[model samples]
Target: MSRAKSPFSPAAVLRGALVPMLVVALWQGLSMSGLINPVVLPSPVAVVERWWAYLLPPDPYDPAQGSWFLWALSGEMLFDAWSSLYRVVLGFAVGAGLALPLGLAMGGKPRIYALMDPLLQILRPIPPIAYIPLAILWFGLGNAPAVFLIAIGAFFPVLMNTIAGVRHVDGIYLRAARNLGVGRTTMFIRVILPAATPYILAGARIGIGTAFIVVIVSEMIAVNSGLGFRILEAREFMWSDKIIAGMFTIGLLGLAIDIGMNRLNNHLLRWHRGLEN
Candidate 1:
């Protein structure tokens, strides 16, 4: 069951902020106190300042010599984030689309499941990063390889979860449908699909996370643009602040995405009692 709702509670927000604010305060104290080298571990504020440079337009009076550079830097952050997001959506959609039907068929029929299980077993264990070299060679860098890598990474979670969800449907449902003379297509549309929705959504959520992980890896090596590439570029310059900023930016985006997915899942599975937390 869910927890009881509280009236507009600043206390709840403060509770959530307690640890993070403490950590930030400690980090700032250590950096400013010179107890920790900023080069080794930049303070959160320093990292945020670096991100601001990459995200904000230049001050108009700062000098034309500097304004162009600031604008370009800001554009770089926007472009990289957009590129990565684009790849994640494309790859996740493609992979999930391909997974659903195959998984449904596999879960519904023993023979079909047997035939597909071997291939799934063989490929499922391999990390998407393992395919990078071949992906680069085959797709030859840029978004193609990154997209392919993301797709491969996102695929299995969805497939496996879909199959599991389908399998989880009560046998009584199937027997009842058959006794009612429901045809195969009608039964699948009215019964199987609804029963498997939760599993499919769970798999999609996992797939989204996987897509993000694989996209970063793919971007680091296969492509020249994205937050992953920005981090690598910062490393080349020995810009610890920028590197950490890029990392935090990626983490923040991933967290936002995960929250969005969790909300969507709860909405879709509102009737599913086991999902309540």
Candidate 2:
């Protein structure tokens, strides 16, 4: 039998688009009415025009800054984006890599839990921003500091979720695995990890978001160049539209990364679909 169409089908695209369209319409209306200052809140059309200008060359006054339209396509932009992205990936990886094993050990053994649980509890509540000063002092103002901040930001979700997942594993499954002559290591890999995959994926998703937050904040403070720096520069020069454009770009990229991660999680956890259904 075929399933019914989901409410969130392609038509939902139009439905979703409506809110932003209304917002833009209202904004344009306000601009025309002169109720809003164009300096602070440019019209939707103006923002679009500026965005287009940034994405394509206008009449060149000087050939250098004239290429502002090509900024998004430039090697510098790509490199900066990549540098920020790399920090996130590396930090998330480090956090997850360390957290998984540590969480497993803590959850799987009471002795380890007794020793480590208190520490994790204490540390987990500290905001990633709190670590920035120390991170800067320890790693200096470069990728190291940025990645360190990202790692700190990403660590807690993975650690906490993994511990929760491992703690809640079905005892019957553990018994069955042991009854089948599975070693502890084999049971963990074949049973616990698979069972914990959902929570792990959830943690990773949160971690990725945290990574982006850390990247932007870290870039703002401790880096010379990145989207954050570009935005700051635009603000300093009072290029309000460019600043707005940069913010939009950051939002779009962050959203794309999140959506991509969600898709990957769905693909990897297909088995969980049966249980949910």
On lDDT, the candidate that comes out on top is 1
Query: Considering every candidate listed, which one attains the maximal TM-score?
Result: 1
Q: What are the clashing pairs of model 2?
A: 54-69
Tens-digit lDDT track for model 1 on 1-277?
Answer: 5674653478777787899999999888889998887788888888998988876654443455666655555556777888889999999888888898899999888899999899889999999889999999999978998988899888999999999988899989999999999999988888998889998998999999999999888888988899999999899988999998888889988998899999999998898878865
Residue runs of model 1 more than 4 Å from their true location after superposition: 2-8, 58-74
The TM-score measured for candidate 2 stands at 0.86
User: TM-score, each model?
Assistant: 0.89, 0.86
lDDT of 2 at 261: 93
Candidate 2 lDDT score at position 98: 86
User: What are the Cα lDDT values of the candidates?
Assistant: 0.87, 0.81
Query: Candidate 2 at 211: error in angstroms?
Result: 1.4
